[model samples]
Target: MLVSRGQQSTLLNRVKIEGRGLHTGAPVAVTVNPAPPDSGFVFSRTDLPGKPSLKACPERVSETSRSTTLEDANCRIGTVEHFLAAAAVAELDNLYIEVQGPEMPIMDGSSQPIFSELEKGGRKKQEAPRLWRKIEEPVFVREGFASLVVLPEERFRVTFVFIGPPPIGHQVVDRERDWEELLPARTFGWLEEARELREKGLARGGGEDCALIFSSGEAAPPYRLPDEPVSHKVLDLLGDLALYRPILGHFIAVRSGHSLNNKMARKLKEGEAGSNARKMFADN
Candidate 1:
């Protein structure tokens, strides 16, 4: 018989932040605390009567608009990928996130706050061996004008293509996981999207200070990479990985969003059934 030794870790302490939800425009506060072994990542809405905690998983997904919303029928939580991404890349296997609102704080329209808080909280190795979902076959899904596919790989890889009206023209990014370089890419919105979102009472407070707002016939702000949209798309994908599955495969995304992300996550769940590879994961 063969056995594999792997590393698993979680945070040593808790981290907290306060801000407003990007779309809901609701003021909220969040605290990420360490959990017992195998707790994974769970969200507790303290604002609700019972402080219902919604665990991050595909099963909890109730909607996928501009952001991902997870609900348990009794309660709902929104816009959580960035913080989840921070925990994923840091390799935290367990966390307890208690929020005092319906959605998480936008926190600079990026995962910056999550990153900073994770670093300050520090990471500690656990006694348990890492449990990973080793991919054996291709799993995929499609949305309007977009698609997502994941194929077997030794490590995580994200491939995305950004295309639309000019300046926001066709762009592609494919890279193996590098959390440090990828984590800082901020979320963005076009003028048409911004205005419409506001008209609909969403993200009315989102501005240049928080997100990268791109308008027609105008140049983009100082960017770290030529195709930063695709990079940020990768960030979004990583955040969604908090579904607590190690997708040992490459994900190819084209004009995708939370909808496609949730779709692909569901498909991946089905494929993992009866996989020959060693699968280690917590209940998400």
Candidate 2:
């Protein structure tokens, strides 16, 4: 089991990254800076007028096709799962992310670069206690064959079962202490779907360097891990869960993606709110 930290933390210094969006293929720059306690994770669209900002929360998730996207009345941000996953693992409670484009840079199509940058910037504990949430009862969400469930646990854990065609038939990953292994696993896709996805205005920026592409029911040599695709699924799940406060539970996902993950997060947050309301009424 993982131990919880008593105090909140933020980056000690600012860090910047520049790359191309995996879907938009547009060049972008991102700067992550430390923020005051309780600030949570906030994103600002620096390229747009007024520099509109939005907090990272489950309710703000507006899109989840090929990636998780957040939007508000004034602005929208796409492909944020990688960065958010890194922050969750780094235990960063407060951060101000400034993006100079509509989508986040898909650096190497993995969370390793982002996680490394955050570590290089260092971390410092803040005065306030860390915001941790736990469920007293199981929270579950499902859609057809995909499902996600969170059960009460003393520490955070994730178990993912990936189901796909051909090259990515079926794979399972159970992660608890070895988060570093998941960071290096890059996003993947079938080579056969490249043209179709591009025609739909997606994966325009994707390339062999940024993603693992399989052809003729076979992936190229040099796999990052035994089952890299499944590991990436685990990474994406953690990022989606980050929308709510840090949770203490064992999350089990089967054929789940961003949409299902976000639904589970909203349910978990709603359950916590209801529990708090009951406690407040009893005290009154």
Candidate 3:
């Protein structure tokens, strides 16, 4: 009895981008290829000779400390959340992401570039409608001060909450979903964390240009919007939900990050206990 929405669309053609990872700093070239209906989103690592490919889904998420990474026991790709977000926002169901490195170029540290690329690729509707995974019940999770609460809703929606040190101190975001409002939210980091990352040679590629860096709790560039942090969290959630393959139910976030996001994603996919909401409203 569940119905989907939107027409399945992909690039009318292929488009490509070459850059460096925001974290790994590795050189990378990623090509976006339009796919057939119901193909879903798939990432192929052309850099690997064997040409290992992984489906962009919660089950494929192997790591999420910095960004959502999709992988399997044999192969993997890192920091793909933004690109995936672009795909989801566009409501494009089928895509082939061919990459030559571990991370997609951190271009502007937002989904802007990816959005441009998606447009360049073009869109064409298929015969089928985009199915939605409407939450029939609520799914919740929490860790310390961070928490995630997803409740059943008629259409796709997201709510975000963030509370940390200054600069990003705290914020909340609420909206139905729009490309303009969501696409502009950029990635941010603290100065000390950025420095430590550099010393450890982890996110060496990350800098002021790719990500907004706050120094000692000061809004480095000043926030584009008051609730930018929460907006970005909503943005992250959108990208992650794209893996769900259709319209998603309501998603809520409270002081949550990639770690908790991935955990919830995995639980949804695995249908872990309490993850289902059928019983909650069964009688209603």
Candidate 4:
């Protein structure tokens, strides 16, 4: 259950899961397979001809409306943040995830199921040392009311704050000792937004079990903890950023969604590139 320092790891066995996609509502089956060291997380379209694969990297992201989507000429996969977050928390550095449909299964709109599956698979260290991004300076991005800030640290940490109208008013969640609290936090939205997404042919699988609905006079879904909405946002943020190597820093996020999370990830990558360039110049 412990990842050795300076060692890479992957699942010891393969695990399969089946559920419905949050956006497409199509029933899908996914299998998590162990990959060689340094492979990173990859998604393969098993149902498609030739089984095209896409690397789960932030630069591969093509869309982030409602959910994060990865796209390439051969395939596109949507709603991947929850699954990715589970992988990140598990310290799974390499994996081959095969999916039978266009989107990842919602799994009650929480990361719990995916994390459980990974736990069942266990973990085994590889020969290579683990890779990670070490932050050297503060990197920050802001878009009006939403912002993400990353400051240098020796380990990963996150804090999230959210503000919304009515029932969802002002929630903040601090990172706990482990990621367990974040796993059960389900995706949520306003009743009006749900109706609009349904009209646009989205959120087809969302319901009382898969998501929390905030509407006057309507019963809310069972909250796993207080301020679960903000917890879920943090879940999404962690997932989106998991595309990069494990990052060493403290991330402070405010009202950020999938789009903003991905933007922060890109900025992190850019920062690394800049750091490398400066190092090379000094060496020369």
| lDDT (0 to 1) per candidate | 0.77, 0.88, 0.77, 0.87
Mark the regions of model 2 whose C-alpha exceeds 4 Å error after superposition: 1-5, 219-221, 278-284
Q: Pick the candidate with the highest lDDT.
A: 2
Please write out the lDDT profile of model 2 over residues 1-284, one tens digit for every residue: 12245999999999998899988899999999999999999999999999999999999999998799999899899999999999988989899999999999998988999999999889999998886786656888999999998888878888899887766788999877878778999988777788789888888898888988888756554679888888999999989989988888898999999999999888877677686776678679
Q: For model 1, how does the per-residue alpha-carbon lDDT over 11-96 read when each residue is reduced to its tens digit? A: 78888888988877777888888887667788898888888886788778888877778898777888888888778877787888
Model 3, range 161-274, lDDT digits (tens) per residue? 778677567687877756556787788877888999899888878897787777894554676666666677777877776776554577788888777887777766656334
| Runs off by more than 4 Å, candidate 1 | 1-5, 276-284
lDDT of 4 by residue, 1-284 (tens): 11225788899999998999998888999999999988999999999999999998889899988899999999899999999999988888999999999999998889999899999999998998886777768889888899999887777788888997766779988773588768998888778888888999988888777887788656655678888899899899989999877877788998999888888888777677777777678779
How many clashes (backbone N, Cα, C below 3 Å) per candidate?
A: 0, 0, 3, 0
Model 3, position 72, has a per-residue lDDT of 89
Spell out the clash pairs found in candidate 1.
none
Q: Alpha carbon lDDT of residue 219, candidate 1? A: 82
**Greater-TM-score candidate between 1 and 2:** 2
Clashing pairs in 3: 4-131, 5-130, 132-247
All candidates: CA RMSD (Å): 3.9, 2.4, 2.9, 2.9
